[model samples]
Target: MTATLPFTPPLALASLSGEADADWARAGAEYAGAAFLGGIALDADSRAAARELVDRDRTEFLPDDPLAFIDRELEALAETPIQPAFNVRSATVDPVVDAARVCRDREAYLEINAHCRQDELCAVGCGETLLRDGERLARYVDRAAATGATVGVKVRAEVPGVDLPDLARGLESAGADFVHVDAMDSESVIADVVDATDLFVIANNGVRGGETVREYVDYGADAVSVGRPSDNPVVLERVRDAVARQLGLEASG
Candidate 1:
């Protein structure tokens, strides 16, 4: 039998700069009811640096690996109340090896990123470029799923010549656990496309207020992924409360 999953909101940590005193646990608690951590950017140098950073605390840290570092940090934060989700960089075309390693070690539900529009990332044939080649994307999903990890894919919607429904169906067929649709700042267009997809829909696009989240959820999204807005408090208590209330209402009636 499939394990039951929580209906709490999934908060995404966008582009963290690794400040000296970043309190991830507190950050998680403040935003969503549960914590889904981000900021695991990997390149050859950065990956090595991160591994070394965790190694210093051998007793507290599990090992010099992606999953261990993430797990250790979460544990140290004592934020057991929230579930952990990770956002990592996919620097190569075939991200399966790294993706599987993370899933195995971190024990996380993997999210294959194909939505980042960064120039450097794009030049490397990562992110949204991955979408252009459906077969490769499918392979990555297949690889991640083979590790017994729940796999999700994030992609941009407005790419030229890219058919959203077709891509969604392909990803579904490739065995993705979820399809993260980047709505950017547009909601209506996203809602329309999301309604057409067969996979579990994670609507992400400037989702700030609860009302907008409600519209996405009501429109048939399985869940909503929100980012930290510059002006809003780090812990978006209002949004969290609103999501919880809406979920509760839905469950009851």
Candidate 2:
């Protein structure tokens, strides 16, 4: 896909939840000098999941004070040389508005998390549950976009019976700045998505190294993202070098 907005680093870090310390994790991510993506930062109003949410898989993060949590995370990353991105998930617009508004002020990308599959989130009509409600999801994206933050919507490419191209079109139609896709085991969806919409497409999943990054880039993704491997400085640097060569950005400059 043609990049709607230019990005020097085509490789970025994906949200890493289940970590012991969220802010500290994000700080380490930022310190890597590659682009950062904070793992699913819930909004102040996203407490809906607490009622029935079982912390299965141990990936669900419920902040005592989400705004404060985000504020601290943003503050910690303030010195990052490369612009970073933040992920936001909420069942309602007010909280997303709150989060995206702050992200706009801070010059960061605020991605709506339609990728989270925790059943707890599903009960609240947030997360991957939005995939079942495309219209609402589109409206949610539209609202997030109105905040003037760089708005992205991350989606799981292999959701049962969900039409990937159709969803991508809907998101783009609703003003999604980009669509970050967790393309599961296939890269073909990356090309399908790029062919389906004008919005920037970011390929994710199964990315183990710079060659993986190059593979996704060649598959028509405007960018690629890495998760756990980003925790390693050596691996992060290798990916960055490959991305710099692919995107022609300098490493030591």
Candidate 3:
């Protein structure tokens, strides 16, 4: 059976490196059903990779204590109606499992990082490397799921040798609650992933208005999320309105 996300209207704010935090999520909460906070580095290896990315002028969360940071950030959103979720990157399974326990205790969601393509991250066996290493990624999902937190995987499209539909099936079998697909340039592939698994499908990438929103919904996406523009109220409004119209909810604008 396909698991359903607790939130509704099927719209989310995707994680944006150092920018997606509790404050950022609150800013987009009015327009979203869920908000993914962080691409937080949860282990020593992943933290090293995060530092490398920072050295390259990229943004990352290199918290001194990842679990404490997660708890504080998630706790900040405890009163909000919008669902809170953490998008995390880890080089090993244990940290992800530990992070999931925090999320479960906080009543938030946990999304494994498999969508990042940065060389620093992949070299450390985090991010996009997981996409190519389906078994390892499934292990992360399985271990995280064992903690009883709602879990999912964020994946990107168009990676060579990565069969996303097959990977989606593996994630479902590993007990993922959803699959957040960054349909880079392969929009049609969303349908394939949807058909391949019972996991809730969240389509991402260029989701700004009615056309994009309707396209993903028509392709059988269970939800849609905004990425870089997630903090833009105008874009969020447009997407929110579009989702409402597409989902037959009362129109927002």
Q: Pick by TM-score: which candidate is best?
A: 3
Candidate 3 ranges beyond 4 A from true positions:
1-6, 251-253
Question: On residues 58-118, what C-alpha lDDT tens digit does candidate 1 reach at each position?
Answer: 1111134655555555445443444444455555434445655555554555667677665
lDDT of 1: 0.57
lDDT of 2 by residue, 1-253 (tens): 1112545566667776544233534544532333435445464335656434434435545667776666666666677555566777788777777877777776777788888887777767777888778998888888878878778888998788788889989988888888889998867889888999988888888776677778887878887777777677677677767777776677542
Consecutive 10-residue window with the lowest summed lDDT within model 1:
13-22
Instruction: Estimate TM-scores for all models.
Output: 0.73, 0.85, 0.97
C-alpha local distance difference test of each model: 0.57, 0.71, 0.90
Report the alpha-carbon TM-score of model 1 versus the true structure.
Answer: 0.73
Alpha-carbon RMSD, each predicted model:
6.2, 3.7, 2.0
Candidate number with greatest lDDT: 3
lDDT of 2 at 29: 52
lDDT of 2: 0.71
C-alpha lDDT of residue 186 in model 2: 67
Candidate 2 similarity to native, TM-score: 0.85
All candidates in order of lDDT, best leading: 3, 2, 1
Instruction: Using TM-score as the measure, name the better of candidate 2 and candidate 3.
Output: 3
